[model samples]
Target: MTDTGPRVRRIDAPRQDRQDTETYPTVARAVTAARRLVHRHPDRCRLREVGRSRAGRPLFLLSVDDGERTVLAVGGPHPNEPVGLAAAVGLAERVLELPPRPGVGWHVLLCLDPDGAALNEGWLHGPLTPARHYEHFFRPAFHEQPELLPAPDGPLAPMPESRVLTGLIDELRPVLQCSLHGVDFGGAFVQLTRPLPGLAAGFARSVARGGIPLDVDSYDAVGWDSPAPGTYVMPAPGTRWRALPDRPELSTWSYAGRYGGVTAVLEVPMWAIDAVGDARPHPDVRAAVGAAARTLHERIAELTGLLPQVPPHAGVAYGPLLRAIEFNLEVSPLLVEEWLADWSPAPLSVSRVTTARIVAQRLPLRIASMLLRLLADSGGPAADAARARARGIIAASLEGLHRLGIRWVPIGTQVGHQTRAALAAADLLLARR
Candidate 1:
């Protein structure tokens, strides 16, 4: 499965020169910048409200092209993954600057989950570190995630934000949809709704051009078909939907795929780990994965044990954090157990070992962070004691991660890689047609 299509040349997006290179912009800041960009180019760009979030924040759509064929770009599907927001903005700017194509229009959804994104803004003003990120971390639970909600037309009603996306899909029926996404820590990768011959090569090249390591084996890349390293073929709706927690519900990419559009999920990372791309065989695959599973289970037990001692009610402000802890508690251990069960004596790559360790160690920090946030928010003598204990756990986890040798990737670097990958994807779509 080589790239049978034309060779993909490296694409480099213009570097951004913001005051704080390491920090990402808040929802308000990102939206404001997007509006200003649209406002600056009256003829080429048009900004309009598409829908409202659950919390009543307006979801705006920025249309940069009026061509017959359309390319749909969505950002911030997961609020915690804000790299895409900056990428979306950059994409819109690039589209505006380019000479008009014959019939390829571009529509950019700057931020899909504005309410959820707002919750994560605390870390936006950061000397961004692993410790700081988890401390201010927030992610809606499975049921609350817009992209993970049941189908818009299903018996289970979709979230207000998801409905907006469904409606947009119906209206645009785009030729290509780029769902911009990012991870807390990993090398860069892309997930495609289906095979688009040369797209993966372009995406890989884009990652290289941005000086980012290619994540050859991501945690989610396990079950997918890969024509190239760092690129995965996401199973269509009915194929592997059951593998995920929310069965039968289509993600944004799958939803777009239903309309005969190809989706390229540009997944970058905030923290960089070059080891994730190493193809060298791990010395002991079974032992590495087994150890990772043990580490995860141990942490899960310790964290879940603390819950009984603390108050159940942490208020609305900490709901996301609470949900994160609850969801991870139920799911993380099971995932690790399943992985261990499924393991065999195969040629496991170093990247696989790195991914395993990341899943085991870093994931628990998120859970610990959520617990700490919940405890801190409760504000009582007992809660204070619990918070202190959680902080100790977090400190140990952070120290463990430091030993893993992960590096912090600048926000601009992440956005640049995503923007380039997206542009490359768009090119592949046009080339396919």
Candidate 2:
């Protein structure tokens, strides 16, 4: 059969579309692109106000329709994972221009958390390294996170943005949904609320086409099981989340039960480890996991511990930022113990090797670099000395990352992979119907 579905191709956004010299558009830049499409192409696009974020930035839902099966694309659920900000904007431009599929609709939430997104805007442009990105990364506490649910009918933190998304989920009840998320380091991978058979390979293709590999190895898979290469089923949150008393959480996709639909989480990467998918034999898998976990916890502890001793740091609000940093750092110490309590030796995967070598080496620097940035911004002798020490920490971490054979990947390619995947998913979904 000669296929005539709308084909997805890698798009090159005009330089002006970036809103800045940085290849990755900031949340503000994406918002401009989304709004421009709506205003300029009124017949094809409509913009609706979703709600206001906790920070009072207005949230919006852009509905693009020629109409096939409608899909709700979510971006910027977390500030630290900013790739979605770019992906959402790029997808909007393409969808608006593409011949609309009859009965297919795309309702895109340009960004769910502008405030959080702003926190990471520092590294959005350049020095696009793991350390640089994580330095400005900001993820809210679990209870406060919008992805957990957005909002309820009544009082429950009342995340206006999530509330807007919740309303959309209830109103649109999409056939398929995808949340664009990225990681600081590792290969590319996908997370699904439920298995989307044949989707994983599509995700791999998208990565490969974009010149990246499926992040076959990932720390994100610690508690989850992979039913397919590059596809991960996030374990239902229960005890693991509860263990962090202060950080109660719920995954946005968990609401998949409330609203019947397929949800795909496309996790791209800031840097790619080519050999992440390797299945070669190696040392004890359990040991690597344990060691990585310990090293992570120790680094977390060291940074968190240093914050208090630095004379409480001054200039620009550090309280919440520090707590946010501490929250991420605090959560890891218990992860290995939790996983290993029932750990049995399985053939160590290549991921295990990368985890011990690369991820373990670089992950710490992510948080550590952020801590150092805070210290650098702190105006004082003690702060200066701390910043100097932090420079050393970052230097050592980079050395370790290089020793582990990690390399940086282009952000533009990452965005292209993501945008094409969404378009492809939309094409396949509309075709099957």
Candidate 3:
């Protein structure tokens, strides 16, 4: 693959500031900032209490309405990916500065999962290194996630947060909706609800300008059709290739489809790994997948085996860890089967191979961290023994991951890239109109 590194983009209205942001803000601080933004610009911005999180934290929507058509941006859809928290606020501030586009309005749902985000505050203010990230990591199980849950009519009760989003979708019927997300380590990539000509290239270009590598070989990207490098068409719900089914709840994009608007799931990396974008071929693709699958399976087994030993604790604090472990156990096998079934003689991209290895290395450590928390929550001889074992596992996982030499991307750079992509997407939608 021809490697033309990140290019500079010259623009006027939406530009990245020189502020070098080092650490992510905690959920409370982020919410306060959003409120302050509205308070400072009450004329252009309106902050409203849309709903409450399960934990009863009031969720607010900051609407900057100087235009007609609506563009909805949901931040912190996943508790672990807090890049969006900053991006949502930044986007609002940037848009307010520009003369409003006559055809477009911006509504940002700042910090969708505030309760879950609070759980990840340990590493939110960073020394954002790989070891710190894994040690402080937390992700809710799919069932607990608002975006992944089904509509309210199923066997499960809909998350209060999901209800807020769906209600907004129905009310605003936005022309474009962007879900902000970030990966722990990889290049930037995006998934769209439908084909939007040149939108993918626009996304790639924005991140590239930030000097963030393009994750051309994301395993999730592989499951969908790409119209451009680093951009994939989100597979329809119930896609057989998807390791986990949406089941009771439809995916956010699918649910948003009813309003005839487009959805974009934009993902940037917390840590930049150039190997994740290298398009060179791996000599033996199947062998690489097999090795990753075997390692991941072993780790899953080890973690799951310890699950029963730790007694169930009250409160939802450790619920995310348990949910995440369950999620991995359910999805890992299906993911491996799909990758192997689709195997071909043609070599796989080096980025794909690298990502496979990185995920295999990191996931176990992530689970171990969660397990440590779960173990710590329990009080017993088994729990004490499990805690010791979990620590040893985490130490080994961290040691192996550190050897990979992942480089950290400044929080400011990540926010800039996400902000640029979102603004560009809004522009494309207005242009199409």
Candidate 4:
């Protein structure tokens, strides 16, 4: 490829900020921060409305011009992973503060799925405990998730938010597409569509500098097969997506791949700092995982049978809290079934151990949070009855996390891990020129 962009000095990662990621804000707050950046620096950037969400929230694209190859940094590809919004805000601000850099333009879609994000806003401002976070947790079913929606080959029509994102990708044809995704447990890891020399090492160092470990036993660890300490390459398309025929939609990265672009997936955890970049092995991996799965199935069955009594809201939009809970209850057990199908006896890695703890504990609590939200958000005497019943479900998940002794990770350090990965990957792409 020939170069067409202007020349500039090497891009430096922004200095760590103590307060930047301290507050986990709602979608509203993220939108506000994005607007603030544009309004404050009218001479530098423009906040454009790319499209409206399915829920009617106006999706935004904050752009600052420079260079030939645009950089599309998508935040909140999945609603539960809100850390990206923080990283996006920090990145845009840093770009605004410094003079324009060459070979890239900054275009950030700050909140990709506002409806799903709003569903998760309950735990953003936190006491920052595992119990509290788990109790407030909410994630859409695979079919309903923002990125997975508008399934690549399904008969269903594309969601409004999916249309907006796809439109942007087609419009920009970026050089680097960083879809910020983080998990609730385990340690940090990197996923890239194509291997970038030295980028993985830089990523591990970046995360380590923030004092986080590389989760050795990732849920996907069994599949991706780590190339370096914490870095993983997603399996080739031919080798994966073998199941779930209904889920055929192209991911933001997959779609961008057609343009010969690179994707950087940064997965960090909300807690479990002790697992940081850990390499040590623990005993009885398979036994613990089965025990955890069995425990989760038992708890989910109880909830599955109870939620129908609570009554269904007519539309998915009407009762976000109740619907989220109901959907999770149905899907939770199915996940354990998949895990069980793939089980094998092996040395327990931190990622695997952490994964079991989360599945057994936090997964139930995720539903409990939904149940509690149904009561807190709005329910009659029925809400009270549900809350009373929810105590058992809520306790189920907490027991596992507490047993494993997972600690709460601060928002700033989590953001630091994600932001650094993006910078490192960006620099890697630049160096190729």
Candidate 5:
């Protein structure tokens, strides 16, 4: 379907009447259309207020069901990642028109962090500006902005929206969870659980079929060397930490790990989604993407049966690993800048240097840490095997850095800092012992 021009149709009108309108626009427009959709299709869809965002926006959950399996998809965990919200709203509209598979259920949580999203609206519609400016303003980068927004009482905090999400997860216990996100100009790929063997390939096919080119070469866009495709770098220290105890963060993959279900994160590049700029999807690509979505949905449903329950060790080793990542990030600016200037013949993009520091230095340390835990947990030959695996992962990662042509000074002293932090975190993790 291609767009001829902008046209308005009544919400209660037939799907054909609404064909000209884009599903995703500004938040207000999306919410208004969605509310109208629920009202029009009362039999198939129900809208519920899950919680209030920090700014007091009503976070709505649109539940579409055929009565058996439940799938929950969420968007807008980070203020800048708004495409997911658009996609979620679009998917909701599609679900209403099509007949659901017998026993299938879908719940879409639209714009989980409206407060963060509201802060991002200024840049959403217009001449595309530089990403750095948006980063500075939205504070999507962890260290760039205050961890929590200020409130009249105190720090406004992550808000009850996340808490309510956790509660909903506990109650509904969705079999499959997909969080939608968009990469900046570079880095593009759909991410699912790390350990799943063929999931990436399957997802890539779906994306290609959708007419969006797979960004196989753009790994460095998000951090990490070009050699290692799937890895993303950790943000610098004083930036946001990825994992924290007793807090509900938007890193819902960890949440899925905790809940023991299959979780997938679809990272689409904004360019791909806006390929035609307010135009309709290309007919062939739209057919492919729609098919891919359906196929993926079915595959995820099937995988749910095979998914293992959350293991005690699932996130148990993350504390020390997190500390290691943090330590690397803390020392990265000096080491990475020097390495990029001397070793790399080309002047590196500032973002690339920042990203590489996290990927090359910090990530290896984090992996080494998990190995330490594995050694402690396993016995006899299992310990030996764990050590070998850890060493191999670390070696491969280091080799990846060398391949990327990054040379660093003897910052071995940083390792000691990492060690101390890891030890402290490990102690805390063990204290609960």
Candidate 6:
């Protein structure tokens, strides 16, 4: 029921120069620019309309091929994450400058949520300040400050743009998929599919080459705090928490994983991009960031070629990795809160300890469910049974904290929510048979 055909008008041979820095005029303007770039490079680029947003905006996908392996990149699933949009647009332009290399191909789904994007267009036109922009569009925070915005009621509806992207993923089936996103106040990082030693090294090199200092701490472990250390907050009781049963199904990554390919989510801090002006700017930052993006693209291209060599059935160990991530999201809060409670003259402004305790208490059941899912997936039937036996202990610990009113969302929560929905959908898929 999604429209996966090109809807916007195409432009032919639009001028391109690094100096021709022009702020986007409007949503219309950005779409026009995207269409034009696709039109100009027809051999390498083809525009496809993927889907429509809830508000009826068309989602456009731009495909570029060098006659080899296909790589897919997408920007803006979350409306507020604009750095990816800018980077994707910039990358699209950059691709126009390079002739297709033999045996390599690329496709980009540009701004998968144009209607959501339009909502924040005012920020792009006015003061492009990061804090102000964040204050305006960050949706998760809306719960804390309900006056900020109203929650949408219904299924996890994809804006028309997102639906288009879903259709593209289902159709094109590219070997590698990257979703570009940016955090307001955080160090630069990449969210990868299981650690590939060679790929990880290349990613690190790309980050260093981009001149953005690597938060070595990020790679040290997985936790809600692991990827972006400070952004997490405690959740309230009855708050929903979920986990990825097998792998994340949001984009092509899960699909690619099924086929033994690499998929990644490249999260760049707004600070990494020179223009956002929230964090301190790095020297030669623009060049570094641009080079980093290009380098990552190149490395991904290499990985796609290498994936065929890796054994498809040789399941990689993601348990330790995901468990580390889960603890930070679900359990770390308890540890942190206990640590803070003992602090002399307790510090203000949501101490890490307090936040952790809140998450643990408020979402114990959810966390327990996540661990069970992970156990089942990892073939730890005994561990899963042991967890079931220990559920009472977990509940007691969580309930004690609940009496104190602490709460938080789990890391990789999206996977849980989507998985539930997917399971329900799968049941429906089976019933129809």
Mind giving the per-residue lDDT tens digits that candidate 3 earns over 25-133? 6767767887787788887788888999998998889899756678999998988888888888877877787776665679999888988888888886667666676
lDDT of each: 0.77, 0.68, 0.76, 0.69, 0.45, 0.41
What tens-digit string does per-residue lDDT give for candidate 5 at 169-240? 776676666666665333345444333322343434334334444545333223322322332322332343
Write model 1 residue lDDT over 304-346, tens digit each, in one string. Answer: 8878644566745566667777888888877676658774255
Task: TM-score for candidate 5, please give it.
Answer: 0.51
Ranking by lDDT: 1, 3, 4, 2, 5, 6
By TM-score, rank the candidates, best first. Answer: 1, 3, 4, 2, 5, 6
As a whole number from 0 to 100, the lDDT of residue 364 in candidate 2 is 59
The TM-scores of all predictions, comma-separated, are: 0.91, 0.84, 0.90, 0.87, 0.51, 0.49
Alpha-carbon RMSD, candidate 2: 4.5
Clashing pairs in 1: none
* Per-prediction backbone clash count: 0, 10, 3, 9, 2, 20
Q: List the residue pairs that clash in candidate 3.
A: 149-249, 150-248, 150-249
Question: Per-residue alpha-carbon lDDT of model 2 for 128-236, expressed as tens digits?
Answer: 7655665665666666677775334536765677677777788787777888888766788887777655566666766776667676656566656788778877666
Point out the worst 10-residue segment of candidate 6 by lDDT.
140-149
Once superposed on the true structure, which residue ranges of model 4 sit more than 4 Å away at CA? Answer: 1-14, 18-21, 238-249, 314-327, 375-386
lDDT tens per residue, model 4, 351-431: 566666576776677776666654554456765676777777777567666666566667788776676667666655655
Clashing pairs in 5: 142-240, 143-239
Candidate 4 clashing pairs, residues 3+ apart or interchain? 135-369, 152-248, 152-249, 213-276, 213-277, 214-276, 214-277, 217-351, 361-397
Scored against the true structure, residue 363 in model 1 reaches a CA lDDT of 72
Model 5 C-alpha lDDT versus the unseen true structure = 0.45
Error of 2 at 390 (Å): 2.8
Runs of candidate 5 with Cα error greater than 4 angstroms are 1-24, 66-68, 128-137, 141-158, 194-198, 209-211, 217-250, 272-433
